[model samples]
Target: MTSALDIVFAALADPTRREILRMLLEDDMAVTDVAEPFAMSLAAISKHLAILAAAGLISQEKRGRVKWCKLEPDALRAASVWMQSFGQFEPVNLDAFEAFLAQELHLPTDPEL
Candidate 1:
């Protein structure tokens, strides 16, 4: 049987859902606003949102007539803890990972990079 963590990992596996999480990181947004940047239909975005909601990555509430989506940052704690367990094998150096990402993306390295 699939666990909640399994569901969350599945939801986060999608690039669109990951982007949605990033957008919500800044602030809550109306469903329409969340759908704006994507090329797909609102229905498609809603499907992605539903997956995220099920994963506990986000929560949706209706206020007035608008349905808003908010990021539940704490929801990631489980995943974070699971990832930390892997640290027993090797330490996670975020700075080095960031530099690696920059190199792979062909972005310039700097104090901010």
Candidate 2:
């Protein structure tokens, strides 16, 4: 069975969908405004938007005669948590690494070299 995480990853796998999400990051936008920068037909952009909505990455609502799309930032919390878990290791210190390498190889650490 496909989990919500799977759906989110699948939705994010498409460049078009990723771009749409980036655009919506600034503010909510009308459906036509979302489609403005793409070369594809409105129907194709709608398909991308549908996938995003299905993944819970975006929410769509009608305002007056126009439909608007908004990014749901919380939808990414799961993915972000999962990804951050892999960052358990401390970041490498380049200077310390260079010193260790020099010691191991019996090389001088002089800046002139």
Candidate 3:
């Protein structure tokens, strides 16, 4: 069976949905307002919102005539925790890692070097 984390990760796979989450980080917004910056039609934005809502990444409610969307970050706790598990490893510097790789492969460096 699919877990809730599975759904959350799936929903976040889209760049548009990721941007929507970032927008909500500031404050809740009217559904139309959330759709404003995107080139897609309101219906398309609504579809993305639905996927986010289903993933528990966001919650929506109607205030008067306007439907507002809010970020539900609690849904991300599991994913965050899972990622933090990898924190035990030392952070690697890319330049050092690349040099190590070149040395291991006996690859020639630039003539200027």
Candidate 4:
């Protein structure tokens, strides 16, 4: 059985899937609009979307007719946490860096962050 981490890595491996995520980042989009930036067929893009959805990177919802896709930001958090496990041997404090950025920007630390 494929682990969730494996699913995430596999989903992200495809350039097309990454671009699809980029498109979804701005707003939820129909499959056809998501496929517009690439030369691939709608079917191919649909397949890519399936991979992404399976990995929990995106979720699909149907409203009446067209299906729209939206990015699951929490899924990226899961992926980052998985990858960070490998870097446990390192000394860098990513949280501290994030706080430093927050301080420099004069923004309060994110509660969810």
lDDT of 4 by residue, 1-113 (tens): 87888899888887788778877889999998999988979999999999999999999999989998999978877778877878763436787778756754467776786
TM-score of each: 0.81, 0.75, 0.74, 0.74
Task: Give the Å shift of residue 108 in candidate 2.
Answer: 37
Please identify model 3 stretches exceeding 4 Å from their true place: 88-113
Across residues 1-113, which tens digit of lDDT does each residue of candidate 2 receive?
99999999899888789889989999999999999999999999989999999999999999799999999979998987778798753447677777756754467777854
- How many clashes (backbone N, Cα, C below 3 Å) per candidate? 0, 0, 0, 0
- Please provide, for model 3 over 1-113, each residue's C-alpha lDDT reduced to its tens digit, 9 standing for 90 to 100: 99877898999889899889989999999989999999999999999999999999999999899999999999998887777788743347667666855754467775655
Give the C-alpha lDDT of model 3: 0.88
Model 1 lDDT tens row, 1-113: 99988988898888788889989989999999999999999999999999999999999999999999999988888987899787752446778777756754466666764
What lDDT score belongs to each candidate, Candidate 1 first? Answer: 0.87, 0.88, 0.88, 0.84
Candidate 1 vs candidate 4: the TM-score winner is 1
Ranking by TM-score: 1, 2, 3, 4
Where's the lowest-lDDT run of ten residues in candidate 4? 97-106
- Write down the TM-score for model 1: 0.81
Give the local distance difference test score of model 1. 0.87
Question: C-alpha displacement of 61 in model 4, angstroms?
Answer: 0.6
